[model samples]
Target: MWWFTQGSCFLPFFLVVWSSTSFILSYLIALFRRDVDVLFPYISDAAANPPESCIFGLMTFVSACAGMATIYSRFKFVEKLSEETRVVNPQLNKTTLVLGILSCIGMCVVATFQETAVTAVHDVGALLFFVSGVLYILLQTVISYQAFPHESSITVCRVRLAVTVIASLAFFPTVICAFFVKQTDLHRVKDSKDYPFHVASAVCEWVVAFSFVCFFLTYIDDFKRFTLRVMTELG
Candidate 1:
């Protein structure tokens, strides 16, 4: 949707090219290596193609939309913290602000590409999306750590640490999608039946979806509690 990503017809884009190459290489690495055989067997889809999409589409849309919501909430949190706090570590605010916007941009870009650009940017944007989610979770954790109460960045640290682990766990399937690509029948935008890829995609989305749900339900309280305790200490 943004100019940065649109109308740049086959610009020999460095990132996309790098990603495609990485896919091939990773696949080869898995193929030749014995360990990867075991690994791939676990991750690989036994089914010929992904399952039907009526339900899958809804689930994908919901997870993606909820991810957008969580990122938006993060933006509001950062804005509030920045105005309330002084310049102790302004870089934290800057990173959170920029990455939060990027998270939204990344999501919108994929949605748009998926809708149009049938042959061009669809999966490419999706790959970028995988990376974007990674960046989103990382930056959010950084913001949490930096804006944590000065008295005990420790508790916040633990929380962020947990967040990071969950985020990382949440990230593996995107990598799997990247690896399988069109080769994996389930992930293909066109009619494909790779059931395992679909299952993997579902699993990952479930993790991310639940992660954000827990984040909103639990971490909103954490943020509010942290803010109040900080203010009380300062007062």
Candidate 2:
């Protein structure tokens, strides 16, 4: 567990799993409590309610940890790439790292500001997370391609690029629909049926989340050696 926590690649893996599972469990509990409407309730809605609020809060906190760790891992990986390509492009690397950190901050903000308590702030956080995520993936995809042109994992990176692209495309439309529906007072009405747009948004949001997680899987190959190490410091 310590290896998983401290390892660069493994940290992201653990975080992805932890965050996803925590949110799912929280959502289920929220559903049972009937605090959130079943059909169109956003991910934030589950975290905002009772009985699952703690779980959701933990998820967000863990997400913040993952985000910061990811920034570190990215910086290290970029350094390695510089050695491989024999080219020093600090500007590009810095940009990718900055965007990654911003995306992480956005996620933390989302977790901190629930849709129920602060709708606008929550929306801003979501926007920051998703938009920065898209930019990070796009930039990293290009960097990975350039950095590892001869490596076999480049193919895998390309595949991840495809997934990120699809997720980004789906994310915008669904989020737009979800927010548009929010403006109609459907979410506020107690007796309203589940709105399709909200449901779609929820589904797409999950896809976006999973897609982003999948993007990080490629890093495992890069950092597998770190996992194999039992200790960073030897006596």
Candidate 3:
């Protein structure tokens, strides 16, 4: 049941991220499917260009933006800490993690306004899915890492290995999709086939996401254990 709870959230979000990556890539691939699609005299078509560009721009913008906001908003710890030394205090660090989660929530506001741009106008639905995908991994990492601090042998040594293995396992799904999505001929599928390089680049994104999930999970588990132990001691 525990594993089920873990996998339920993990698999769904994995599919969500995979679908976005695949959908965008397939669109790009169609852009280059034909034998001479990218000819020099090629006239740019608004119908083909705008919608797809909007699709990508909206999704990627929302995606990367949400990811940035996760990292950036949490950084406000510097402001709240009001100290230049970068000292790590457990209490303050815990507050930082809490604020980080809030930042993830704040991404919703930014996502809602994506439609202010042309590309994102009709595709706002995609942003919702993108936000979930982004948050799942972030929250998953927070769950994983909040437990034990970096100084612990369990976290830095043994437990870290287990989490790394879990992360490495998560990449196969995205990597598999990225593999079939790549093609060298862009002109042929000018409106279809994804770029050969893009397939590889997308894999890098999945890796970061998987690692973030692993770390976040650690944080949550550690904190939960700490809380329970504290309760028992008090009782």
Residue 187, model 3: lDDT of 42
Q: How many backbone clashes does candidate 2 have?
A: 0
Error of 1 at 119 (Å): 5.7
Clashing pairs in 1: 49-193, 49-194, 49-195, 50-193, 50-194, 185-194, 186-194
Model 1: residue 6 alpha-carbon error in angstroms? 40
Tell me model 1's lDDT, rounded to 2 decimals. Answer: 0.46
Q: Give me candidate 1's TM-score against the actual structure.
A: 0.49
Candidate 1, superposed: residue stretches over 4 Å from native? 1-88, 115-120, 150-157, 181-202, 222-235
Cα lDDT tens digits, model 3, 1-235, are: 5532342233323333643563445355445543224322111111134444444445544545444433333333323333444344445445544544443344333333332243243334333332344444434344334433432335443555565555445445444444465443324343555544344434443453445444443332322222111234554
Q: Rate the local accuracy (lDDT) of all candidates.
A: 0.46, 0.73, 0.39
TM-score, candidate number 3: 0.32
Predicted model with the maximum lDDT: 2
lDDT of 3: 0.39
Q: Give one digit per residue, the lDDT tens place, for model 2 in 68-127.
A: 786667677676668676654778888988888999899888887777678889889999
Ten-residue region with minimum lDDT total, candidate 2: 183-192
- Most accurate candidate by TM-score: 2
